[model samples]
Target: MLNVDGKVVVLTGASSGIGEATAKVLANNGAKVVLAARREERLRDLKSNIDKQGGTAVFKVTDVTSHEEVDELASFANDTFGQIDVLINNAGIMPLSFLHEKKIAEWDQMIDVNMKGVLYGIGAVLPYMRIRKQGHIINVSSVTGHIVNKSWAVYSGTKFAVRAITEALRQEEAKNNIRTTIISPGAVVTELANIITNKEIKKGIEESMKISLPAEAIAHSILYAISQPDNTAVNEIIVRPTNQEI
Candidate 1:
């Protein structure tokens, strides 16, 4: 039997892309999924699909940028499922632009969603995991986290921060028996590119995505991380399309 069977997973950013794929994959493997995202309609649709397929899932409309909402999401998941075995900090945004463009709002949004949102998720789940001395926290970073590129300064900064934070959490919580994993994915064809305000960059990204991996590729990486045994920790995974050089 898969280790993911019977685990209660709280997944954020689950309205689309990697989050959505991960939620379905885990649910199909017998996980009790708690989907979190800002779009209630999408969440409901996802839950309905999962239910139709004989997978257990529920959803909470949540904005990860707000600590209060994240807290409530954690509470709701625990209240509904009895405990949260896994928390996937998957809410993030990438509004790529040159620093010279000075798109401060986009930068702020990225920080709030990518960096602080992950922090809030960690904060919300730590107490419960610590008390149980057992849990898994999977954070979604990016290829930009390891290799910075043009127009990716702010987005890369947030992703780098994710790796840093996940590493620290791993070190700090080893005694608590909590597992931490950071998934850094390369270009996958997803809605993330739609957020780019820079038309030129967006065009280039779309062009480059001609050979990108599917969101399910990254979702399977997450499933692999979650399927590890209690004594093993698959700490980090960087998955890119075979054609992606960077």
Candidate 2:
């Protein structure tokens, strides 16, 4: 490991699933974790647990869809921790529905939460990282980002945009000493599937969940990426359960 001890890490979507898992993993490894999410109660609970484990942590209630709130989150982390070593743009939503279903509202929600949210997080942290000339940005994508499936068009589009954005960021910030990583996971057991409004799609996802990897699996991958030496940037990691074919 590259000694992440005392490193300041700011993680979005810290209330549940992969975000919650990553917070615990990083905090236990000695990182000062700043947790951000819309749910204040959940964030507080998570922070308390981390403290109980002798890991340092703090929480900020934030809605990633709002650029202002996201900016405040970054500022909060910096003000509280003194510096931010990493920013994890892990907040997202998955509401799969066929295009013909005309779930325009759901489509908009996904775009806002999944695509725009990632962009806002980057915008919030890039300036601070650029000034420091040392930081890492991790964005969560999905296997659907690589290959679209039925009723997953909009969801996949958002993830694909995430991949594109992360790669471009990696290229642009490399000389500035800012590392970028994209984590693409396949069917991890999380609350993401609950957002699917389409009956058929929800059923399909439930069936897939039976063999899904736990959120901790993705958290381990994140730890691995951030643990690398400054000169080595793990650009992309695609993780899935052994039983998963996609």
Candidate 3:
């Protein structure tokens, strides 16, 4: 076993979806998880659920768009768990729209949460990791990043930035014994689809959801990467349901 016992993990977007599942998975595997999200009730529910299953967890109300909020989340994790061994920058928003429609508000939200949010997460946790000389960061990208789609222009751009940032961080942090991994998932069934504003796009996404996957599959991939030996940095993982053509 790679032995993640008692490792403190700082997780953003922990109220639902992949972040929520990963929190549970890592805690069940003996990691002390600090959860962050904008939804207080959801975070509390997730913490309660984890506790019911005998896993350790704490939640901080956070909006990843704010640097101070992200910094506070990291500080809270350190205060609660003594040190952070991992930071999962899993917070994101996907409000898909065509360029002609010009959903500027949606575009701005995606840019803030998807791109700058990840950057804020790095800013918050990098200092602590550098000080400790050990850490792991997992950035959640999307298959849209690797392969562009019609309405996903902005979302794909953000994820591509995530992948590029993750790779750069991995190479730069290697000397410090810090590892970075980027996870790109395709069409997994989650609340992400609900964010699409275009009616036609939303309809297409709902249909695509039929061929999507369970969140646990992504959690399993995350566990697989986290459980690898320290010397082995599994830098990127892309997963999609076998039935998902895109």
- What TM-score quantifies how close candidate 3 is to the native fold? 0.98
Would you list the rank order by TM-score, best first?
Answer: 1, 2, 3
Off by over 4 Å in 3: none
lDDT of 2 at 80: 94
True-structure lDDT of candidate 1: 0.95
* Clash numbers, per candidate: 0, 0, 0
In the range 27-89, model 2's lDDT, one tens digit per residue, is 999999999999999999999999999999999999999999999999999999888899999
* TM value for model 2: 0.98
Give per-model TM-scores: 0.99, 0.98, 0.98
Error of 2 at 42 (Å): 0.7
Name the candidate, 1 or 2, with the larger TM-score value: 1
lDDT of 3 by residue, 1-246 (tens): 345778888888888889899899988998899999999999999999999999999999999999999999999998888898888899998888999999999999999999999999998999999998988999999998899989989999999999999999988999989988899999787899887878999999998888888887898888888788878888999999997776
State the displacement of the C-alpha of residue 229, model 1, in Å, after optimal TM-score superposition.
0.5
